[model samples]
Target chain A: MKKLINKPEDVLADALKGVAAAHPELRVDHQHRVIYRAEPKADGKVALISGGGSGHEPLHGGFVGPGMLDAACCGEVFTSPTPDQMVGATTVVDRGAGVLHIVKNYTGDVMNFEMAGELVADSGVRVETIVTDDDVAVEDSTWTAGRRGVGVTVLLEKIVGAAAEEGQDLDAVLALSRRVNGQGRSMGMALTSCTVPAAGKPTFELPEDQMEMGVGIHGEPGRHRVPIAGAAEIAERLVEPVLADLQFGGSPGIVMLSGLGGTPLLELYLLFGEVAPLLEKAGVQVVRSLVGNYITSLDMAGASLTVLKADDELVRLWDAPVRTAGLRWGV
Target chain B: MKKLINKPEDVLADALKGVAAAHPELRVDHQHRVIYRAEPKADGKVALISGGGSGHEPLHGGFVGPGMLDAACCGEVFTSPTPDQMVGATTVVDRGAGVLHIVKNYTGDVMNFEMAGELVADSGVRVETIVTDDDVAVEDSTWTAGRRGVGVTVLLEKIVGAAAEEGQDLDAVLALSRRVNGQGRSMGMALTSCTVPAAGKPTFELPEDQMEMGVGIHGEPGRHRVPIAGAAEIAERLVEPVLADLQFGGSPGIVMLSGLGGTPLLELYLLFGEVAPLLEKAGVQVVRSLVGNYITSLDMAGASLTVLKADDELVRLWDAPVRTAGLRWGV
Candidate 1:
């Protein structure tokens, strides 16, 4: 495998070191494998924390900053973080206001965050959890029991993080998180499979002329493999299911077309060129659009589409200042 | 080639459609193929215009926005933009103050931009040209007489763009641009070759167990092919030549490690983790660092590092707000 890494086992540890070195504003807890903002939020503001397996970058760790996540519990590649790490982050970031755990709807992640919340309950810390499951690709996947959370998790964190930074209570943040989760829908396909560092080879074998539609982030089997087609047709495939799954029509919406690690940014924009028109034809009015690699699988050449039906409040919060390595603006 | 494009011939036009569709803040002239700030700069502020072949995305076009570039003329993939396109952009973006044409050191680009400057001289728009040759890879290569202008172009645009935005005159902005180019040095390597759309195949052959060090942005031959090694060893290989060519110790520097389109963000961070310490040990104090795909070669699996020795002025300008599709912060 051609990868810029020293050892497979050291991937997460070494990458965290790089993250700490690159972003001085972020504080990395080496021992616990948690990333935190150097400065804590205000006393009455709700603190946010999220975590998952490592490979999908700029997700939990890169999002740790003032306006997004307070702390991110990082696990090994494609593996869940331990409850102890989550407990440590919850207790540390919590102020007089409560803490919110923004988790994707994966079985291991949900279970671990739930366990951590219970473990921290005796410490007199109020922790509320909002699980996101916006992936319309599949109802159940390799590691998930229900819909797997995908790109909407990034949107939810940005919008809800803004609400929390503006001094919203935990209950209000939780409600907003759910609303964003419910309104957002995502569908992804892969032109190629990602090679997990430990695995040392591609997760799955896709023929040169074939692709996996409705694929999961972890290379889980998609709806089916089909002959590779033009970008316009692929955009229709990704957008049709997402619109069918969620009622995104006749309202202002936020759209994100994220690259799946190995795809070029030029192609992502090309795909979005096709995606935006399709969404509009279906009656979704896109107000804010992000076309880049916000959340990505490791070295997988593909793209995903997420459409979030937003009202004025969601749009305003998304427009608020955010200072994170992954997503930064208005600050 | 398995790119997210409809036809190889239609890549640039289709991607431009996406660029216009995704970013409402930027105005794309489909006919002239120029991306400009939707709202032009004020009359007295000097304007910055940059353009190059298309494959290396987020380079010229993505850098066009406030506090950065006033316009970017896009060419076909890896092909120089026409002289007429450059002439049109120079005349359109020239506020009462002069215009700065930021051209990379490729032969076709340099010649075309120079011709365009001469063509617009009669139009009465004062234009000053700055050709960047910051690659420390080789003294001269296939398409370049001196060094190939690589990642430093991105840094030059950001630092100098801020100067132009703050009302620096054409002469002052041109001086700053030259200073940035002179102080910055870059070295790149590739694990796999990028596939140009029209070529319908990999640009060059890279064996499974070897890598090309000092590789050019367009898959041009590098210094040599070496056995693939660990990240730390590769980091040492990239940093040694850069430090040897220039004295970078004892000053604050802005460092950027850009992916060549195909490497994962996890690996980029991991590689930066290895790169940061090597520079520090060499006495280059990295006051600021950017790790992502700012400049890219379609889908080559590798990275390039650019280090700019910066003083107080350059550092302050670098910290100023920049809001572009590729790089956005401090706003």
Candidate 2:
């Protein structure tokens, strides 16, 4: 695989420096490997924080802003950020109200963030967390660290971040975040495998005419491999399981058809076109929809689908304004 | 260049059906190629709307929710959606306050959305628009339609969506959206070209050792091609121009370092690592930062960086709560 970097070993350090230079509002604690909003949130606002392996961009870090996370701890390319890094983020962003850690359901992520949360809690800062187990792949996949936190992490951050921004207590924010996670389900597929910079090769080999279905974001093997089909068939492979897992037909829902980094918007939209009608046929009403590369795998050519059931209140909350580097709406 | 469609012609239609099925809350007006929130916004709320080609998924459509766009028009892959589709979306979502159209800077996207706005205005609906021209790539280049909208569109949608969800007047929303576009700039680099399914080939060929800089999201050629460099060098290539274009020093700003589809998160984070300190050394304070794949090329292996200068008001709005499929925060 071809790559752009001076040395593979220096990739992480070099990229962090570039990020700090490009974004003046973000402060990089290079020593701790954390990226945060330069100006911390107002005192008393519950700080929402998250982190994980370095591969998922705009995720734990891109999301650091006023309406989203207070700080993000980043690990080295697909490696979990060290516990020390998470502790540093939690300590820096904590403004007294408390801190909530939004952890994806990966073993390393969970372990690292949990350790950080504990370390911070020991310092008497309130720290609460919600683990996002949205990917319906498998609890113990051969390729992934575990059932990876795929798409729903985006939803959880936004929802929980909104709660924290509203000055909600830590427990309330944690509850709402957990609720959103509980109600959401996601599944992914990969057309082509990605090569980790460190691994220096495709994480997994996919045949030219086949796709890995139910793949996790971290280059994990999916539930099955099938002959690559049209956008219509691919949509079925991604959406059917999501619907079946959550029974989205009974109520209004919010659906996210996300690209796994390498898929084109054309194909994603085409997939949406195919997925939309089938949802309606199934008696589901999509109150809202989002398509893009929200939570992504490095450069894997694929997409993932996530569904969230919404009541009137959640819908109202959904409509609220927010400003963040990655997601800004209603501002 | 390998794709899975049964027939190239069936891509769009088949995909829409699948979208409708997976996301029941969103209704896909197949005839019009519009994806709308199943439930319209309250009466008198300015309807926020956006559209472009189908390839940039979860964009105009995925953003349709309470705090974001009320509806989105989708065109064929990499091609702008038709005026009729935009017309339909504007008409159905309009609640008397007016409609705001968020268009990217591409010529086709601008022209199509403009035509749709005209059609809607003819029908007696008040419409306003903001065209995002954030990509710093040269305009009217050999391979590009124009400076591609790139990453700033995501920021515009969220900020403008927040204003509209607050029941701000159409003019207010339009102004805010435009302000975001004006304050932001983006530049991208590609390691490998993507294959548009219809084209069934890479958009462009780059020698394995070379990379394309200042590339656009639609597989457009970039400003220059050079032998691939290390993460630090690549970071400098992407960041220098952005910093030169705007004065990021003195005041805090928002920075978005996004992957153009195929770049891995590990590389992305490494890129951020290189960027963070550069901004700090320049005496720029980063108020917010985001690193990820929001806007993308089909499957091009590259990344982009976007910088937006933010003020107190923008920062406050950024802190507002939002709930949507793509962006949810401050719940």
Task: Give me the candidate number with maximum DockQ.
Answer: 1
Q: Residue A308 of candidate 1: its Cα lDDT?
A: 97
Candidate 2 residues A1-331, lDDT tens each? 6765557666667767656655567788877888888874698999888888766665767778767788888787778888888787788788899888888877787887877778887799988888888888676775346566778888778777777787899888888988888889888888888778778888888888788888888887778898888766877777788877776776777778877666665566667777776776787777777766677776777888888877776666665665665666665
Fnat of candidate 2 is: 0.52
Residue A134, candidate 2: how far off, in angstroms?
2.8
Worst 10 residues of 2 chain A by lDDT: A139-148
Let me know the DockQ for model 2.
0.30
Looking at model 2, residue B302 earns an lDDT score of 74
List ranges where model 1 is wrong by over 4 Å: none
Candidate 1 global lDDT: 0.93
Q: Candidate 2 docking: what grade? A: acceptable
Predicted complexes: DockQ each: 0.89, 0.30
lDDT string, candidate 2, B1-331, tens digits: 5553547766667667656655566788888778788874698888888888765554666667666778878777778878888888888888999988888877777888888878888889999988788877777754336566768888777777777777789888878888888888888888888777688878788897788888777767778899888777877888888888877677666777766656665566667777766766776667777666566665667778887888887777765665555556665
lDDT of 2: 0.75
